[model samples]
Target: MKRLWLIAAICTGAVLLAFAQTQQGSPTPQTFLLRYKGKPGDVSRYKSWFVMRMVGTMPTPAGLREGKMEYQSEATYLHKIISVAEDGTLEIETVKESGKARMGDGERMRDLPDRPYKRVVKMTNRGKVIESREFEDGEEEQESEEEVAEFPIASRRYQPTYWLDKLYETAVHNIAFPEQAIKVGDSWQEKVSEQMTPNCKVPITINSRFKELVKLDGKLCAVIQSEIDAPIDGQDNVGEWTVAVKGRFNALMTIYFDPELGDEVQAIDEARLVLEITLSGPNRPTLTITHRLISRGKTAKLD
Candidate 1:
């Protein structure tokens, strides 16, 4: 259970940190090539995707509950979101799957790779996302009441709405302290280590300063790992949380700056960010997120 929680923490933190790259004096309007992977030996039955559900204790008028209740569910991206910034900076939001819909017996969400979604994102000059809107393209809209009633569907969307610098600010809150890791309602402490990148050419070096921070993605993230932790369910007697696995695993992230892909001083491109992660605490596990950059635009428009 500790190892499982560690894996969940690392991967989910990585994704959130990567998405929260917007920080003070950092590059703006950037996009990255994202890939998330996870493989917890005995923690879960899910191997293909990361599941965010309810667990742990909860606070109530009566007392503390043994297990939390679940009210929402959504998974991180198996595929990545690629976007070119207007300033020539390539920005890749550590992508993930997130959408909730009500169904017959239970709620059904369109949060799979094959499922399609339309989103509109607006950003500022500093690469801060101002707003995000989702387009509801219902597939079962035409179904009959009986059929639809049998499978009632409602949808929830997770969108990014902040700049890299802004997210950086959020992450600082998750930085580990001696007392106990507490800020966003949880506390944790783990051994941290610093690891260098595979090659020396990469500007960013891998290190053990791993910590969690809140961001516009509706979760907390770690800098070295693209992991995420968020509230999934909250109601009467139960509660649940979701954790997205690592992106840019093995502390190896693709760096793409101007000159190679687009403008130089304005952007950074990370390919397969969080593709692999190392687990060595109580549990020995390693997960690799597989992602490929299909294509990139000349100038990304955020309006």
Candidate 2:
């Protein structure tokens, strides 16, 4: 009986030791909560580049006219944290540095200057833009209605102030992050609305998923995948013509974000748009436009 008790005691001790080891080896699941952590006076800079290609066929009284358009642009964005409230709301001033765009067939429309622009914006820690200003440019002259009416659609879209506003709007809308703590494989949705023109409003829906946590460039980062769908609605006056767009817009984006740094390290986005544009004015006809756009960017601390 004594020998049996000794063996039983040994077995119990072995089991307890094994259980303790298992408990020590097992790791707790990791939870990530994303929030901006910039303090007053902190600054960051990002280099962004994009290429867009558009092809369209329009029916004219003569026949079908087909055209291809392409443009590429690069710009630098600088963000300065002006203040941080106790509730984690941030007031930031953003500046767009000098930029250049190349457009038209064979890039003949080259060396187009992008005027520097600035804006002050307030945002929450969860990446919600509370308020934003109309960007100001040094070279922007107040155009009369007559002058605006004579501008082409392309010129209106590529105007320095207009481009800057669009970029800022895109950045604000792209911050579709999960509010609560999330683990890998968690998903969320964010809704974004934008004014494509004075009278046209577009609603965009974003589906975001946390794909994985991995090390990128020696820094731990979270890899996120997002899908975007937007539909255009309403009618707007573009230059000399009244235009309406009907179509589906879709995009796929991947972002590598560093939680500790409170910034995106790198990102890639691709989109395809099929649009039916109805134009009415002097001698315009309905047209179909298809566009493909790709953009990439990287961010770093301004030291």
Candidate 3:
């Protein structure tokens, strides 16, 4: 349960910078109302890959030396919006293309044969995630002891699908535009929630500014800078294990939105998180799995 919680928290931690102004000529003194614009059934494809590394000490027993473990994951995802609402909310669906995860690397890497995992997200134009549902075929993923042990950290079914987690994080943690338009240097704030548990919700603070206008892939894009912070601390009973976690999570993101197309054409983002954990249960002994997670990725629109 400790490891499971840590994985979930890491996804939340990505619960997603500051680029100081450069001598590049100031952006036109024009305010842009950045929002997604598309008619119902209008489709768009997004492809992105991110690498996450966890390095730190794991929890130790009462009299034992502090044990430590670290691992790396690399994954690619394919997503497309299938529908849109009049209010700007949209429904998205995606699946993992391929990748190595948890301790599954080197010659041990096993690509999911069927790629039977999928996720559907309903998100508001302001970038809030209204609902996210996951689907996977268990029979298609039956594996051996060695295979199951390698993916012990991320999910209940022992499937190393961190990309789905990344997709979930992207859907839930994102920009919420301000009501009014603004020019470069204009700043605003937003508040969202992270579901630590059914009854416990943690508020996440997001500060955004219209950093500048830049050109990418030959299209003019609004370069918005943002700072995301979440102080997550809590405990809960998850099945047979008793779990507790506390940590500070933060990220810096620079998004390039295509105003004319009303869609995000590209984005560069990174995040860091440090957490302390404690756990106890029948077979699962108390564990720490202290970790610092670093994530780097890029997302771009394809038509």
Candidate 4:
């Protein structure tokens, strides 16, 4: 009888736990009201002011490291080809960048590349990055693996698809799937999620919506960054990302630009956005991005 009672108690506890989880599932979607004054650059032109602070566990070739850092970046870009004619090539260029990042203990790092760090992308019309070469300045050979792993590093010499993904995800509503195109959103809210790989399968979730146009720096600019929820990469992201540790997260972020920059103001196009993503799961770990900053500098303009 005692053994049977123990079994019953375990089952009851499991039921209650499930119920609690269900209750927490319906989280009130966090919202941010960002009102700023900026110029409304043309959608075709590119101009941006980006800032990011991220803290999470990062895996390096040597092992894992923990730290926090922030970066401020600016850029001007031009879209050389929007809809290419048959046999025509598309091009993007970066004009300028003046940015720095603060590592743990406020150690300043400098010398980052600008926008359009030189990459060749092949994608269907639906806006899915099929394949491309990630930028890597030759400096990797000079530094030891441990030295290279230090945080708050910056370089803008090369283009990375991950940054491109951020830019495309924010603006492009539809993406090309293997067979057909998948619509990210049609109306009010849009949910964009991606599973980053190599170290572990850490999924990133970005929830955004169309906010009103606000004036910034005496120019009309579009403001975005409704909500963002991400799990710590590495071990913490183990066991399918759940609602508990991963869900108790929110962000207040904004994307601003002068309409004069137009489509050039796209997130990744304007500058390399390296945000310090935070993760508070079973183990407490902090990580930072120590990589290229920005290289190209081209003013945003219509093709």
Candidate 5:
């Protein structure tokens, strides 16, 4: 009888050991189907900041001259969902709460007017822009020669208005997600084309991967990593000058998204670009410009 009891105890111990080994061998995978879940009257407040630095070298009659220019800007944006259709279309009103910029020799410009700038955007639930409109500021648009010549390459194309427009557009478009639910380690690709000017088109291809789902500021968030590649080659008329630009761009972006809210909580984008510019005139020397840009944005409850 003692031998029988000993045999029974050993059998129980062996079964327990086998169960533990099985548990350790198979780990559950982390996966989720991310979608936007929001309703009308939902409000989100966003703050964005960008810093850009450019170094250019141009050939001159005297010799080669090099110049450097830097620009920094910050803006607050308020987004309100006006209506949500059953089909998942959203009408959103975006207001520029405030903005300020600094350029040239590191002198901070005065703050923008107290009045809010406004824009209306229509988008789909999957982060596609259907339409967008910018309210007029009522001031006549004018460009001074001094402003045009400030930084020959960027001054003409990269203005405060352009930056602000791009910023709002990005916020409205958000991220391009996959059609089906994705799990960690899954990857996807998207193609984007934008008309930068009348004759210039910028084409970008992005590769994205789901990195992980982790807690951010006490909120569960999915982190996505993306790589952006764009090549630019176009000619466009800028005021009295016809400028030709050829460049290559590369960037990396990390986005923190709240799956429940269906919105981006935060994002960081860093890019490097190199361009060769040729103006439309005799004896015009080609200018080589290298630019670096960093942009960041965060969103929170309005109240």
Candidate 6:
């Protein structure tokens, strides 16, 4: 729908404007060390909302046609510090508290069946996942669009290393910072490779910058910006359909981190992507899909 595109456009513009305003020419000489230093038994409750709109054009038997799909959800999670290693690494266990989702077509949101999905992650103080494990406590719910949206962060059971970003890295501006003091205007880069499937490996570089300091809820928060522009295209053959796809995933992420508390206060992520697929053996039909997602999360700590 045109409305979805308009909303995406507006959000994209807002991201650019907000980042531009934080570009102070040459920040001061002072610096701060940012780390994840939660003690064992520390708990954090995070509440967030995810909205995604998909618009596409597909070739049907009749002719070329347009298609649209959208998903929106509100979810909650509880992250508890399981253990802290002597080397500053940590084991954190995250549990899905509740989730509610509905179709984007004016459908009212409803609760996802009451269930608890759990994940335990091991990472250094810089928020890089060294290991991740996901498990559910009960029987799997029937798969559906709403179910997929319910656990957008990590898979229910098996999880690849790259998928671990949804739990930690994205909340911290996608950076695995060096053990060094960082100042405003300082930037870092991390090269990452993600395995989408058994045969598909996508590689990307994440760019992060300490933009500036800001005040939120009367707390001085450090603003960090992250960006990802990666191309993920491949060819596949399934049953009698040969598919060739091309796409780029572009995302803009902003993090509001509390330096004194050594934790995050809020995070925002906006991603827009377009993919073109050509299917052979079926009159060489082509499809073009555009996807836009906006996510916002806030955190509260409980000891």
Residue 218's C-alpha lDDT in candidate 1? 31
Q: Residue 10 lDDT in model 6?
A: 13
> What is the per-residue lDDT of model 3 for residues 25-111, given as tens digits with 9 covering 90 to 100?
764456665544444444444455455555556545454344233344444455556677778777766655554544432334434
TM-score of each: 0.23, 0.71, 0.66, 0.38, 0.71, 0.72
Better candidate by lDDT, 3 or 5: 5
Q: Candidate 6, overall lDDT? A: 0.55
Instruction: Please state the error at residue 302 of candidate 6 in Å.
Output: 8.2
Model 5, 1-303: lDDT tens digits are: 001111111100000000112247687565565544466787777666666665667776797777666666666677777887787667777776776666663454333243446666666655556776666467545767556655446564643234323432432244456766677788988777667656777777778898888887776678877787777788866665666777766667676766654556666666566666676644654554433333333333322
lDDT score, candidate 2, position 216: 83
- Report the C-alpha lDDT of model 2 over 187-274, residue by residue, as the tens digit: 9887777776677667778888989988988877788787877775567675667766566566676777766555666666665666
Give the poorly placed runs of model 3, Cα more than 4 Å off: 1-28, 59-81, 95-114, 139-174, 197-201, 236-242, 280-287
Quick one: ranking by TM-score, best first? 6, 2, 5, 3, 4, 1
- State model 4's lDDT: 0.31
For candidate 3, the per-residue lDDT at 240 reads 63
Residue 137 in model 6: lDDT: 63
In what order do the candidates fall by lDDT, top score first? 2, 5, 6, 3, 4, 1
For model 6, the run of ten residues with the poorest summed lDDT: 8-17
Question: What stretches of model 4 exceed 4 Å from their correct place?
Answer: 1-79, 82-104, 107-116, 120-132, 139-199, 215-226, 232-303
* lDDT, residue 210, model 5: 89
Shift in Å, residue 83, candidate 4: 5.4
- Alpha-carbon RMSD, each predicted model: 20.5, 15.8, 8.4, 18.7, 16.0, 9.3
**TM-score for predicted model 1 compared with the true structure:** 0.23
Q: Between candidates 3 and 6, name the one with more favorable lDDT.
A: 6
